[model samples]
Target: MTVALSLGATANLGHAQNTLNVATWGGAYGQSQEAAIFEPFAKETGVSIDTVTYDGRLAKLKTMLNDDGTVVDVIDVSADALNTLCKQGLLETIDASALGAGPDGSAAKEDFLPGALSPCGVASVAWSTAIAFDRKAFPKGAPTAISALLDTAGFPGIRALPNNARYSLELALLADGVPPENVYRELATPEGADRAFAALDKITGAVRLWNKAQQAITWLVEDDVVMAASYSGRLFRAAAGDRNIDILWDGQIYDFDAWAIPKSSDNKKDALRFIRFATVPARLADQAELTAYGPMRKSAFPLVGKHPVINVEMLEFLSTAPQNFQKALKFDAAWWRGNGAALQKRFAAWRARVNAARTDREAARKAKEAAEKEADKAAP
Candidate 1:
């Protein structure tokens, strides 16, 4: 049986709208969240739900939304894309009052964590950037700090890091002796770029850059690399599967995942109801438990206490515990939206340069081998 909230006088039960189109990533998190929360909510409210998964949500929004106005009525977006959507006027501003306002006729926005609520969206989950390592490789204790990953001399192992400029620049800055608070400010200018690149160059030969979550995790499990910076949720999945992996929250970047309603959605009322229902503390907690992502609702904390993310007692063994959210940087999505194309060109060129170097080295090796063979034959 499907469980749903009552559409009494407070809810607009008369409309009988039976459908909502939701957009989210298609993964463990996506599937579980949809099944546990969205599906149940639909059953309860009589609002049927459909899903669309896009690997790159910002790009997806651009493609799916023709600017004729309406696109998917509801979207779950990362903080980075959420910022971009807000600027592009692609999202609808949420009214807290209508969303079960706070006491004394005021809205209940305070129940959520700071910065979780937005004019156009509200946070659905919190994910952190953290280190995942092979526990079997280091049974005594996992390296507990981000700085530890950068210390090639002390912690000898192949490391995999993300190729994205947003988090990469911050990690480079952090490794280069720039404090977390000063990372973005320094990188905001040209000089900061020079410093960050110089720092990154030191570890270039030791690091393998990865574009996907699974690649990074696989590198750790396959013993291809000993340590990697990866999405926390991915690590959770890996650990759940008994990969002998452990995560360290040291210097991990935390980001909020938000749920937004399109301003142009024809089903505005249904969309709002869906958002409200999906975000209810208990329902959101269920999603968090199944997916191992952090819940945005303060009320869900109790429900999520048993989840790995909220396992305070075992936190010392976790990767994200040492992560300083205060020092961790937030990606400037608006800046990226404007400059992404140019930056992508630069990254592509950089990758090509690396490939070219490898190609040249291989060609030289072949020539050397041919010369050695010719000299031996002539001597004989």
Candidate 2:
């Protein structure tokens, strides 16, 4: 019996005869998918999700591809990586029409966030990096504006930031008083670069850089720093564990992460079925209930529920929420794609210099202490 699926009908996949492997970021985001999609889908369709985790590194996927294709069936990738992979023919072309319709009978193509449904991939979440702080650190008051990141005197403390120059430069410019709309324009020039570097220099000595989102969260948990620029997903996860981390959505840099099928996927049938099952409107909404990442489907927005453990409404924490999202700056991946190499080299040099200066300062302080102790002994 060939069941017909129309534009209005939702897809309900049958039991999977074989296992389907999924690749995703294994953190709060992965746990959300586990609760919302993978576990439920496995029970419903009998397709156990053999999930693997990876940081968003494009080269890893390329290197993993073999004669038959990639070892994984479906992948969760960033929008930027999706574009790069699709252009390189590293991914399989998915029929966008195969996606399930929304609960309100809206077409799959229409229910999804604009530009989210693509020929090669489908967007899962829209996440962002926001200025996060420990509420306990600010005994006087919490910062409500983006400029608080640069005001060392008003909120005196060390800050943690991601090692990426792209976000650092953007936030530096934002804190330096460049208006949101004009940020990219200003950052495109030499003086703007100097201004941004100077803005960062205001707290360069006080900044503790982190390589992972979790590292920044750890610092906050330990009270090693007052604030950090961190991912919404990591913050939400930390908050769920009873950490007092709070985020100011002001000046957040947001972007999308999509799911793509590698060209080498041997189990394309089960993979396609899994994709459809995972992206159903209810599943998308369910995932959002568990994490701070915004579902890429507009239909999922109204269906978003409260956190199962924390019991707070999820919408308020989302990057796409009306109040929080209004002040956000959409991360310009295309712009970065064009200018990243040069800017990255420049940032590397600056970091090298900063590290060297810190080393020299530490050495000088130790030498001064030893000299003072020797002088005290002679006087005695």
For lDDT, the strongest prediction is 2
Encode model 2's per-residue lDDT on 1-380: one tens digit a residue.
11122221333453234466788888777877888888787667656677777777878766665453446888988888888889988899988788998887888898887678888999888999988888888889999988999999999887888787889999989888888778888888989888988898888766778898889988888988889889887777776665577888888888998888987776788788888888887898898898778888877888888888878888878887667877777788889887778778888877876677668767998999999999999994
TM-score of 1: 0.75
Candidate 1, poorest ten consecutive residues by summed lDDT: 314-323
**Per-residue lDDT of candidate 1, residues 201-291 (tens digit):** 6665567778897899888888988888888768877766654787766566677788888766668888888888877777766776666
Per-candidate alpha-carbon RMSD to the true structure: 6.0, 5.9
The collision pairs in model 2 are 69-264
Estimated TM-score for each candidate: 0.75, 0.76
Model 1 alpha-carbon miss at residue 321, Å: 8.7
Q: To one decimal, what is the Cα RMSD in angstroms of model 1 from the true structure?
A: 6.0
The lDDT per prediction is: 0.69, 0.81
